[model samples]
Target: RKYGGAIETVLAHLQESEERLKNIETFEERKEELKKILAQQRENYLISAREIHDKRTKAARRFEKEVETNLKAVALEKARFEVRIDAPNAADLQSGNNRRLTAKGFNQIEFYFSANVGESPKPLARVASGGEASRLMLILKTTAKAGDAEKSVVFDEIDVGIGGRVAEAVGLKLKELARTQQVLCVTHQAQIASLADQHFLVEKETVGKKTRVSARDLNEKEKVEEIARMLTGAQITETARKHAKEMLGAAK
Candidate 1:
């Protein structure tokens, strides 16, 4: 009985194999049809890609203008920011080979910058100093609209290589930006730190061959004292405390 059942199963398998061979016989005709369909789809993709490139070009121009305008606010008045979009020109795109395209498409966008007048713009990464990059990033991320309530922005050492009025300007810029989003800044500048809504003291200590870094919040008095400490280092003179108080009062 088992041998009989096995023969019947083998017959069912042979029937399925014959049906699959029939499909293989017609596969060449279907394959050619699919190739033509895919070619049409490829052309459609190129058309859509061109539209995306055009939109990005227009948006890049607007973004460049906006960045240059805000550059003046952070003392980069003479600096020029440019957005360079390198893509297959209309002729190359029309070639329809699609071999030159990357996963991100045919466009490669880059930022160029000149930090001073009479100098030609170079790539932003190669040319911009830390402070310049920081301010540029801040301006780029800043929105003209208010209330990005769910977003938190973090700034680390944005005040580098700047001091006096420029530092104050940067601090004010952070304050203004904080109105829209939560701004967390790490800075040695008392001007900037004093503008913060809350203050934290971060300290590192070593014990029994283990080292740890910890951060703790400061109260109103501790915040004032901490700002004063930033102003005068570990010494914390009375004059610096008074100045720190004045800064806090001004913030209010």
Candidate 2:
């Protein structure tokens, strides 16, 4: 009886061990399934990212062409503007074979420019002057397709260092761009100010010990006067008003 009881206990222990082994094997199988699912998701993400990269590459080329064409209108006749897409190599990633991605894309963009003939294109920050930069930005805004975040574009002193025919070109360019997008340009040149769909005069006044700055929207009469003032400074002459009227008429 003792021997029989001992055998029964050993069999029960062996049975318990088998159950534990089976449970362990089942858990390992589940872990492998989870790993496969994670890998598949990663593949899908990479595929989508690659598709986005391809689209941006094509769009970048088109954007570069449009901006270059507009640059000529801003009097940069010999200028060369390029939009470069710097895509990363697979070897640069942490996994060595995986894509390096960011929220924007897997590529970095740089605007390169050369303002004069025979000059090699250089990075925008390294090459373009303040006026050149402003004009370049204007060209970009004029040609670029508006995104969700770009509701309005404002230009402050884009007419700086530019006048005469160039200023007129800038004015006409801005006016044309405004047809497609909302544009607010602050300019002191009579040529540029005359083209505004809505004109506002910015003035500063001394009240007591403090200085205050105010912007007042101009009516037709006010616009003419303000544009005349821009043409001849504080002295609004009759000739300047007649010239301002002519300019306003030509702008339309």
Candidate 3:
């Protein structure tokens, strides 16, 4: 009986060891499977991020190059353009969550300019004078639309800083752009506004004590009156109205 009890105890010990080994093997197999899944997910995320960055980089480079080329074609050869991209730290790029390109992304892109020859290009915000800023904005916007597949482009206050021949050049540029994109400009300048496919007058009127905004789509006769008001400001004289008519006819 003593020998039989000793044999049973040894068999119990061996069975416990086998169970423990099996448990350890099962845990190691699960760990390996999890590692493989995680690696595949990481790879997929990286591939998607790279694809997006490539597309955006391509578009940005194309637009910037085209604008620079067009500026040189015109006499505005002093203009320069750039796109700034922020990159991740090496440690973060290697170990952390996958990074992706966004609309704004981790980057800040700004248009830069230097109007005068031999001057370094500065940020658009640093530009001085309303006229210079307006012109710069127009040039940037116009050049951006140069390769646009759109059918219409609208300019609000495009003539803010321009007058005389410069204003005429703006009008001509608008007309040229209109060849591809229908150009709509809101202007105080009779010269600039006259180039529109359609012109409407915006005005403020006081009814009782409340001032309200109103817009009028002017006919040929009313367009003359509206242009006269813009030229003379509030008091529309006969001479100013006649001048508005002449300006309209000249614009044609």
The candidate maximizing lDDT is 1
The regions of model 2 sitting more than 4 angstroms off are 1-25, 93-99, 102-104, 116-127, 147-150, 207-209
Screening candidate 1 with a backbone cut-off below 3 angstroms (N, C-alpha, C), the clashing residue pairs are: none
For candidate 2, report its TM-score: 0.75
lDDT of 1 at 234: 95
Estimated TM-score for each candidate:
0.77, 0.75, 0.57
| Clashes per candidate, residues 3 or more apart or on different chains | 0, 0, 0
Q: Write the per-residue lDDT of candidate 3 for residues 39-122, one digit (tens) a residue.
A: 887667666765766776788788778766655533445667665444555576577544533444433355666767777777
What candidate 3 gets wrong by more than 4 Å, as runs, is 1-34, 44-62, 68-79, 99-141, 146-155, 172-184, 205-210, 225-252
lDDT of each candidate versus the true structure: 0.84, 0.82, 0.68
- Tens-digit per-residue lDDT, 1-252, candidate 1: 433468888788789889999889989998999999988987777777778889999988898898888888777888899989987777776676576676566788888999899999999889988778888878877733444879987878688777777778888888888888898888898988888888889899999899999999999999889989988899989999999999998987
Model 2: colliding residue pairs: none
The better candidate by lDDT, 1 or 2, is 1
Compared with the true structure, the alpha-carbon lDDT of candidate 2 equals 0.82
Positional deviation of residue 133's Cα in model 1 after best superposition, in angstroms: 1.3
